[model samples]
Target: MDIKTASALHRLRLISVPEALSFPALLIFGSVLSRVSDIDFLMMPLGVLHGILFVIYGVMLLDVWVKAKWPFKKVLFFFVLSLIPFGGLYGDKVLKREEADSVVAARAREAAQA
Candidate 1:
């Protein structure tokens, strides 16, 4: 893959962490603290931030999926994974492993060519 295509994966992986956390943070602020804090004021901003991040993450994921030519099942799995709290950490790990494997494969190709 070209650097741009591969870098899309890296971008998606980076956004996954913040996007994952934002949802739970929204939940806690929106639901759990609905009664306890007067900071109900924070709810809208948190929700908006989460919404924006969620959309951005989805877009980045789509970009990566297309560039990487991932299977529908794999794309669906990652989409579902993003919905679960803290699932991004797991996703990050998986992406790292895949990145490592791709790097090794690319190196092997280069070695063979040389």
Candidate 2:
């Protein structure tokens, strides 16, 4: 992948954690916390924020899928992970390893060319 696409993937890796957290947080606030306290008002704002984060995640996911030529199954796996609580932690590690592997491959290519 090109530098821009790689950078986008890097950003997505970073966002995965927060996006993952937001889903659970939103659920807790809307379902459990809201009924017990006045913080119910906070649900709307949190939901909106989560929505924005999710959209950003989706956009980056699509961008990486296209640019990185990731397989459909891999793309779907990442998407499903975003839906599960704390799944981003595992995803981040996987993405980190993927990034490291790609970097190593790129360097090997350059060395071969040289």
Candidate 3:
């Protein structure tokens, strides 16, 4: 992959995990808070933030899949993983492994070309 694509993929990989975790956290917290108090209005902003992050995560997932030439199964796995609480941490681990492999492969390709 080109440097720009690699950079974008790396960034997306980093951001996605936190964003994924944040969504569920906000939901659970908001639900509990609503039951305990009258600060239910908090959920509105949290919901919007979560929604935006979800869309960004989805888009970035597709972008990384295409740019990295990921298999459909792998792509689907991450997509589903994002939906589950704490699954993003697992996804991050997987992405780290993939990133390492990709870096090595890119260097090898460069050496071969040179």
> How well is each residue in 1-114 modelled by candidate 3, as lDDT tens digits?
656556656877887787778867887888789989998899988888878877888888888977888899988998998888888888888777777777777888889999
User: Alpha-carbon error at 69 in model 2, in Å?
Assistant: 0.3
What is the C-alpha local distance difference test score of each model?
Answer: 0.82, 0.83, 0.81
Best by lDDT: 2
lDDT of 3 at 63: 85
Clashing pairs in 1: none
Q: What is candidate 2's lDDT per residue for 2-89, written digit by digit as tens?
A: 4555676798898898998988877676867788876677788888998898889898899889878999999999999988888888
Query: What tens digits encode model 1's per-residue C-alpha lDDT throughout 1-114?
Result: 545655777888889899889888776758678678666777788888888988998999999888888899998988998999988878988887766666676677778889
Q: Rank the candidates by TM-score, best first.
A: 3, 2, 1
What does the lDDT read for residue 106 in candidate 3?
80
Q: Report the CA-based lDDT of candidate 3 relative to the real structure.
A: 0.81
Order the numbered candidates by lDDT, best leading. Answer: 2, 1, 3
Better of 2 and 3 by TM-score: 3
**What does each candidate score in C-alpha RMSD?**
1.8, 1.8, 1.5
Question: Model 1, residue 26: what's the lDDT?
Answer: 76
State in Å the error of residue 28, model 3: 0.7
